[model samples]
Each structure stands twice: as structure tokens, then as C-alpha cells.
Target: MQSNHDGKKPGLPEIVEILAVSVCFTYISGGEAVGAVGLLIAYATLRWGRS
Candidate 1:
């Protein structure tokens, strides 16, 4: 089983992953929607993890 531990920090890998998914979601468009969704996802994950 996985240990109950969190990552040391949000690094380049996390950012790259967010960007990759955002790009996939907004494939042919470039706008704040992608940024908002990405940030929303990040925030949601953070809050969810703590709770």
C-alpha cells in the first residue's frame, strides 16, 4: 500500500502536467479558460487533500 505522505513541493513536473492537460482540453483554442481550469484543478486537489 502507498504511504500516507505528501509531496515535498509542487515542482516542474506538476506544472508541466497541468499545462499538458490544459493544452489537451483547449486543443485549438488559447484563452483564460484553460488557465482557469488548470488553476481550479490545482486548488481543488489541494483543498480536497487536506480535507
Candidate 2:
């Protein structure tokens, strides 16, 4: 069986989850600050780790 790894280096579904969470949090937070920060981090990670 292929072992599933859920580490810091997450996969596609994990990234999608993060994005969804970020969107929801940003929506609830009611400001650009939290959303912007979350989005920036996500984008940076996606870009830097584009393997």
C-alpha cells in the first residue's frame, strides 16, 4: 500500500483546503489585512514550491 504523508509539504487537496479556509477566514474577518496576508503566503508557497 502507498503510505499517505500529511506533512508540511502538503499536496493538491491540502492546498485547496488551505485556499478555501483562507477565503472563508478572509470573508469572516471583514478586512483586507488577514486575507491579504493569507493569500500572500499561499501564493508565495505555491510559486516557490512549484515542483
Candidate 2: C-alpha RMSD to true structure equals 6.5
lDDT of 1: 0.59
Clash pairs of candidate 2? Answer: none
**What are the per-residue Cα lDDT tens digits for candidate 1 across 1-51?**
443337555557666766676665565445568666876577648743533
lDDT of 2 by residue, 1-51 (tens): 433553357678767876776776677668576676777577656754543
TM-score of each: 0.43, 0.50
Task: Specify the highest-TM-score model's number.
Answer: 2
User: What is each predicted model's overall lDDT from 0 to 1?
Assistant: 0.59, 0.64
